[model samples]
Target: MTAQTAHAAPSTTAIATDTAGHGTRRKVLWGAQILLAAFLLIGSGLPKLVGQADAVETFDLIGWGQWFRYVTGVIEVTGAIGLLIPRLAGLAATGLIGLMAGAILTQILVIDPAWSALPAAFAIVFATIAYDRRTETRQVLRSLKR
Candidate 1:
């Protein structure tokens, strides 16, 4: 075989291997996102919906009333569901980032200082997910513009 042909074969194989690795990484990330969504829905959303003691206390601290708690709960649940859908995950993550930002601000300004980091961490995670899915988000926005 020609020397050039031998070099070209390895280059093509490397590219194929690199693409497969990327696909595996993407699947792992997608799985993690799904798990996060499920946790948010079950752990946070349900408690608020049911008026759990801690959730009630948190709303009291926010001073926004029970109605606001219900609204926030609904938003969380909806966002969590949206996160499971490939096409909507970016939008869902964006919405979660807003919610987490509010939580972080509240923790810093009104609630306990030690708790602020929790929401900040969640905000970072949501931001990462949003960044990763930016292309899908752009496509969604483009469709809406039409």
Candidate 2:
């Protein structure tokens, strides 16, 4: 190797180390995000979808009809499933994140502050996935040419 090459900003070993660290962080974040999604789907989705006792009451109190809850529940379930798949995981996270953001606004504007949990939890999960899989997010953006 030439002297210039030897003095390159990132040596091979340095690049490898950086790559490994990023990979580890990515794996950890993705795992946590997937777990969060599962909780959202099971804890919130099922009850809402089935119109369980408390779930029905809760939705009614929030002025969100049973049909609305059912639709959101289906979306949550689909997003959770998408999170498990590598190819569509980014899209899933994005969709869920958007949904959660809407929920947060609705809670603040239309409902009570107590409903913030749904958005708060979803925000954390969304951030985790976005931060960990930034490369994928970037690629998607690039494809959109935006």
Regions of candidate 1 where Cα sits further than 4 Å from its true position = 1-14
Which lDDT tens digits does candidate 1 get at residues 1-146?
99887766557788999999978867876887888888889999888999999999999988989998899899889988988888888899999999998888888888887998987987887887888788999999999999
Count of backbone clashes, every candidate in sequence: 0, 0
Residues 28-135, candidate 2: write the lDDT tens digits: 867876786678679877777888898777668768677888888888888888777766677778888888897898788777879789787878778668666667
Off by over 4 Å in 2: 1-9, 114-118, 134-146
The weakest ten consecutive residues by lDDT in model 2 span: 128-137
What RMSD does each model have against the real structure? 3.6, 3.9
Best candidate according to lDDT: 1
TM-score of 1: 0.84
